[model samples]
Target chain A: MVKLTLNVVMAERNITSRELAAAIDITPANLSILKTGKAKAIRFSTLAKICKVLDCQPGDILKYIDD
Target chain B: MSKWLKFGINCVIVLGRISIVFAYLLIILPLGNFYPVIKGTLPKTILHNDNFLLLPGKHTVTAAAMQSFPSWPYAILILIGSIILIWAIIKHLKALIIILTNLRDADYFAVTTVGALKQLFIARIAMIIGDLFLASGNQLTRSWFYLVNNDGVMGATWSSAVADVWMAIFFGVIYVAYRYTLTLKAENDLTI
Candidate 1:
């Protein structure tokens, strides 16, 4: 099972979902889902865009928790 | 818009856009390139020109001759083909919209399933388009439409050779899209 945790990353960066969405051009609703790890998949391009905007690696935004 | 209508609208819009794209890749590009070859060379070569005296490998039709093969007829055919294909897609989209609209009042879970179906449809269309490219007998068509058959000009047909590299590139793109839409469970959940 794939488990992703991105909320902690956002919180650590002091980035609101709205702000992150604005920076990445995704809807806040989508960003919220992504942050909450409810996103079933993340585009590497989008992830790269997020990394560039947030000044972090994908590892910063995603952590896999094994079930 | 409700998720249902929004989803339906997105389906229509995406289908229209993709259909146009397919026309360009499959028919327009080949036929467009064909026009020049036909109009510039045909009559002179068909009866009098010694162009075909050499075998296919030995004979490389000149730019002018290549452009003259189908000439006016090619253009007319291409124009007709584009119109018909576009119309067919529009009709298809309308039907889809009607079906999706009826399902609008469906439960969220049902709506989500419909959304997945839409994604699957999109993926399928991409794959079909890719296959058409491979079948188009050119590098540009072969590579843009699919992956397995791009051996380049000599590897297949004149068109296939030209489209081979491009097909390779698009194959990667299709693979990525297929992976995203069908494989990545995490991100797909959101789209659903």
Candidate 2:
């Protein structure tokens, strides 16, 4: 199974959904969805956007967990 | 200014107004029509229609025929387009269901579904408009061809052109509606 720890990362960084969206140029609604991990696919550009905003790596936002 | 702040305020105001409107439109309005029913029984008919069955005009007939062509290529295109539209709609609806189901305690799945739903809605509307344009064009083409061949090619060419233009305009209105209903932003994730 694929596991995501976006909440942990967000909390650790004290990032707000609005701030993140502004930084990445996405709507907060869209950012909220991604944070909650409901997104089916993430674009590399969006990944870069998120990485840049959060000051983290792609691995920090998403990861694979054994089912 | 802030997206969340704006979203939060808009949602509250819109939802409150929507509820009030929903009450009037769905419940109050229906009950109000039953003044005698409140005292006796409801009206037998909800509408005051005279059972009119409207048949299409020449132009409308042409458009409808074009839209419903029996040609294999058109059939395949429509089938594929419909399937894609349905898929997008289903995905979005499923996302909404997830969110509603977990409102009190939303999980990642619920949140992600919201984003997915928005994207799907945009995509589905766009696809539908494209399909309509193609279908409309196909129909008008056939109509013009029949008009030219049967009724002396040059005699009614101008009239057929006018009809074609009207059909295009009608489809244009539908396209505009599809665009207006969508909430869109450039995707950061998607790059050329």
Best by DockQ: 1
lDDT of 2 by residue, B1-192 (tens): 466665665565455445544434432332342353344322122112232122244333344443343344433443443444344434444544444434423343343445544555464454454445345433433453232112121122334445545655554564455344332322323221
lDDT tens digits, residue span B1-192, model 1: 487677776676567567656644644433453544555643342334332133323334355544434445533433443444344444445435444544554533343444434543453343334433333323322232221222221123434334534644654564456445544544455641
DockQ of 2: 0.08
Chain B TM-score of model 1, please? 0.31
Fnat of candidate 1, please? Answer: 0.35
User: How much TM-score does chain B earn in each model?
Assistant: 0.31, 0.32
lDDT of each: 0.50, 0.49
Q: Output the number of the lDDT-best candidate.
A: 1
Per residue, candidate 2 scores C-alpha lDDT tens digits across A1-67 of 5555777888899987777778889887777667676665677898887788788998998889887
The residue-by-residue lDDT of candidate 1 on A1-67, one tens digit each, is 5545567777778988788889888888887777665766677888888888888887875666677
